[model samples]
Target: MTWYRRYGRWSLLLSWAPFVGDPLTIVAGTLREPLWSFVAIVAVAKVARYLAVAGATLNLI
Candidate 1:
């Protein structure tokens, strides 16, 4: 909780990352981060991650 209080918003930028992403989201819920803000940020992060992956795959192909 202390870590989240300090780094929560910054960390949300990486909420698209695997492994750590799920825990970060759970902690966000436990800490009661605002629903709209959480969804907006996480949605952006996830979309960015997928776009990056798609770009990389296309480049490799």
Candidate 2:
């Protein structure tokens, strides 16, 4: 929560993956109800952000 308040979504992602545990088992509380969790939003947002950024860069190139 501190990280989320501090660095936003990126911090959340790092917290989820955390280099010492199994991602498949981490859960991160997103898989609870599929309609109410920061995890799903964060993941989707990150992916969308990357795609948007990539598209912009490609257009520029």
Candidate 3:
């Protein structure tokens, strides 16, 4: 609770982490983060990660 809010917006970035990412999402829910904002943050982070990986795999990065 306190830990999640402590990080504030930065916590949204943690959604990209491996095992810890799920917990961070749960924390986001428990903290009642703005729905669209939370979705946008997580989606962008994950999509950016996948795009980076795809680019690297294709030797574009």
Candidate with the greatest TM-score versus the true structure: 1
- Model 3 score (lDDT): 0.84
TM-score of each: 0.88, 0.37, 0.83
lDDT per residue for candidate 2 within 30-55, as digits (tens), equals: 33423345556567656766776788
- Candidate 1 wrongly placed segments (more than 4 Å): none
Residue 12's lDDT in candidate 1: 82
In model 3, how large is the Cα lDDT of residue 60?
A: 100
Sorted on TM-score, best first, the list reads 1, 3, 2
**Positional deviation of 52 in candidate 2, in angstroms?**
0.3
Clashing pairs in 1: none
Clashes of each: 0, 0, 0
Estimate the Cα RMSD of every predicted model relative to the unseen true structure: 1.9, 6.3, 1.3
> Considering every candidate listed, which one attains the maximal lDDT?
1
TM-score of 2: 0.37
Q: How many backbone clashes does candidate 1 have?
A: 0
Position 25, candidate 2: lDDT: 26
